[model samples]
Target: MKSLLRLTLSVLIISLVACSILQREGRYFSHPSTISKVDAIGSIPVRISLEQNWTDQTRMDFWFTSQGSRIIPYSWFMWLEQADSRALFRDAGHMEQLRYLPVASSAVNPAGLPIGFALDTDTQTGDAWLGLTCAACHTNQLDYQGTKILIEGAPTLANFVLFYQRLVNALTVTGKDDAKFERFAKRVLASDYSAESAAELRNSVLQISLAVAQRQLVNALPATYPADFTSYARLDAFGNIQNAASAFALHDLTNRNPPTAPVSYPFLWGTHQSDVVQWNASAPNTPIVGPLVRNIGEVVGVFGDLSITEAPWWQRVLGKKNSYSSTVKMLGLGHLEAWVKDLRSPQWPQQYLPGIDATKAAQGSVIYQQQCASCHQVITRSDEGQDYIAVKTPLIEVGTDPAMAWNAAHHKANTLILEGTKKDIIVGDKFSVQAPAIELAVNGVVGLVLKNPGEALKAGLIPEEHGKRSLLADELSSIEDYLQVNLAAREKLTVATKAASLLSESELHGLVYKARPLNGIWATAPYLHNGSVPNLWELLQLPEERIAEFWVGSREFDPVRVGYRVDQGLSKFRVRDDGGEVTPGNSNLGHRYGTELSDQQKWSLIEYMKTL
Candidate 1:
């Protein structure tokens, strides 16, 4: 036994020594080393060439003419430049207040944090080398909130180069060229612009930065505006700013260029819409956010040679200096385009459980008409003269505000019966459903997020469809029957309707009005018909009363503007110029979460609604 014990001890000691040696020397994850050491080992600096049809001349033409095809990605050099600048613009816009007047430095993403790297090696820079890769945008610095939560991107907007110039200009205008200005500009903007002369201003890096920022903003619009876009801002008979036609409309794919308004602007489609609100957990989705400047540092970082190590297959293909030489790069680019094609793809509802009750809904319907019908008519094709959010009067914070408390009063419409005692309201026995299958359909719809990535790409995953499809015909009939008899009939419910004071038809579709629905309904946020809105939850929270917030040019939801939301990397901002005073697809639309209900009525209705 003693001999056996000695042998075991010796074996253990030998094993420990072997492990220590292997830990120090092994190439595969040698603690101090890196995963790259074993998994992949080649550095490939990407090489880019302008697509044959695209030349530097084309880029110049694109700028002055605003030509469609000429300005877009088919021209490899232009595309690369545009993509990088775009990434940078978003960073800058978010980092600083680009839209609002009191444009202040952001507390989230501070100044420069390695947003873009200019490749400048001998024999490795020039027109062919001057394009942006993945690292241009999309990279995020996780801001440490605490041990559990980490938020990424600080002063989360543009880089120091862009922000500094902007700061200098604003400061020069305000004449607050005090010590703070100097310190802020030098520390944050990182540019020198103290000359009092006009020539000095012109010669300063500040000027160059401003020029770049201006060009970047203009270039953010896609090369081709869809035909549906309409122009609204124009010179009226009075020679003042008047909405004449839709500012942006969709056009043919083969159009010579994106249609121009005397005053051009991006279509705010993909902005928040109400159609998808049934999706709650379905709020902000991560897939919606594409690359920020730093998103793909690994993919777009300085490549050492014509080789790929830690890249997806496609990046590896693009990394090959000869990628364009081989058709492989083309194939890879095509695939990548498809993936990015639906950046604002509607992520199906994560939990679309519309589970509305019928019997209580039946009883509740009567209350809905008495209280809500005056404002939110069940009448068919009714046109209330308010934008979606405006008419709904959606408050930014639900439970936080006394008037617009979302959780405090859910069933004001009386469709929802508060079942519990006065202390705490419970709502199960108040409303009963003839069919419980609504939850099944809602579930199925919500399940799609996990089920069909392909269908989502096609934009077929509407939350309403799930509601309509989820319930059986009888179930819908019951719910509709309850609503119609309760809310639609206009008998003695002598409630005075609030007449909407609207701008003219042209004005309604004008840039200002067309932009109404986009305030803060992030559930449906994404590229409108023009692929404009990018943040899902952010769309829902847009404070329409504050016009400048809409102009931030990036998608982010503010709870102060939108009452409810969840963060999941949502995307989109599509707007339909529904001709009525309100935006499109919203009329006496089906009553889901009956917005027609007053604040109190909505509380009652929502309370009753949750039981369903």
Candidate 2:
């Protein structure tokens, strides 16, 4: 009986492993090796003709600069593998297979890590770590007749959820398999390889793996609803950031909420001057504190280390206030913001794609003035000091997906241990047990800024107009003003939740999705705030006439439609919009503004938009 049981257990383990592999195989579609190579012979460098202050070197810096986010230890990421195979996980070929843009090995990126993957080192400990930079989600590439055209600041088709899941699986396998652990240890500690060192490394891997698994559990979308799953080009950034700040940082697991509202990554070209950022327009772009605070929250969400601990007895006795400690690189964030100011929107590559018909474009210009100009205002891409504010179209008016905007406005969390903590460590009131997730995030940012005031100042946290700045006085005032603006915006959103009868037109506008300038709208497609409508042609159709379901994760351009070719390519992730409860976050409804136009007029408008 004992011999039979041992054989049965062995068979069961093998069966389970086989099933896991099959599941992953079904979910992820690997691209062919040929697809990774750019056919440079016929390719044209696609970019706007407008001259900017920054050079290509500056662009590369923006692509690779680290923001102190440590997704995993540097050695582990360098030598990790897939859960089921000996193949390296971060291999350039494997990353390309997953749709991550490949970068050649260089001094700046000696490992030849994919674009946006960077090395971050601890200033005090001299320990190196591996993490993602902004380019991971923002850089894009399109295939036009086998020639690849790189578009900076455009949304990438990389599968973020799959990438993270694979990493977690790799860590788990390395911890369990003795052979894998031995190999990983040897590579990580080549000079000091020993049983003792291997054991230590294994423990560290297991602990980190366990922590990552817990986070995935807390943030995972409902399995019952397929629409909530984040595929290529979309992420519920707000939800994830909230969970990171209020749940993980505070060590309150119950405070977690599933990240269900996935939206396309917005292009960064004109974001520097926009009055507000984000799909829901939740973040106000105040001068000094605005962009810095927003970037800090993003880094924290993306594996940046943040610890909220009780103040030491000596400090409490000495009247030194408590503040959250974080690994966010403040100066690095400032540099990124400055670089973004110089980014120009990409124009139509007439050489590769079909040229715009001048006559149709002229006709479309008239239609644009009548239909689109009110919301998506025309802008001069070359203007340095252009003041462009995104028009906040109310949910009831534009009627796209409401999940993202709704959650941002109303998601509340239990403050737990943070109940009585100062709302702002430098100066402000205390928090209550029940607070909005945005409030908690703001408090976390404020605490981190106060904890490192010198770095914050050097990072340009104060406006230059506030000359001869006192760290405590000017910085605190600016932060407070910024905080008030955020809080006031949140308040409007909260109150707007009341019955329509009780709401004024202005109050109703609080629940909105911002209509941004469409300078590069042709390049950033899968239209609407939710990214449900696949292409411009379908976007101009009535809600019911639009494609009910389509595949995403393709880089092949559909020049005629001005979006990616949705019929097929690398990934098989289906984006559905059946207009039912099952597809809450993926609804391709509303935005009925120009659906009544003639087909010829619609085509004309699309032609004109390519010129923008």
lDDT to native, each model: 0.22, 0.72
Task: Give a tens-digit lDDT track for model 2, residues 1-612.
Answer: 546534543443343344334323321111111112221111123333223345879877987899878776665676787788887777766786667877665656656677788777666545566788888888888887877777788887777887888888888999999999888888777666788867866766766676666666667786665632687778888888888877767766556677888888888888877878888777777566667887898898887756676778898797654547777898888888777766778888788788999999999999999999999998876663364778988887887878887777667788775777666544456778777786787778877876766677567543333233334334455445555554555445445443432444334345778888898788887788778888899999998788867778788899899899988865443445344443768788899978999999999999999988
* Global lDDT of model 1: 0.22
| Candidate 1 local lDDT, 500-550, one digit each (tens) | 112232221111111222211222222222222233222222323111112
**Against the hidden reference, what TM-scores do the models get?**
0.23, 0.85
Highest lDDT model number:
2
Can you give the lDDT of residue 363 in candidate 2?
A: 97
For model 2, state the Cα shift of residue 142 in Å.
Answer: 1.1
C-alpha RMSD of candidate 1: 27.1
Off by over 4 Å in 1: 1-94, 98-123, 126-594, 597-612
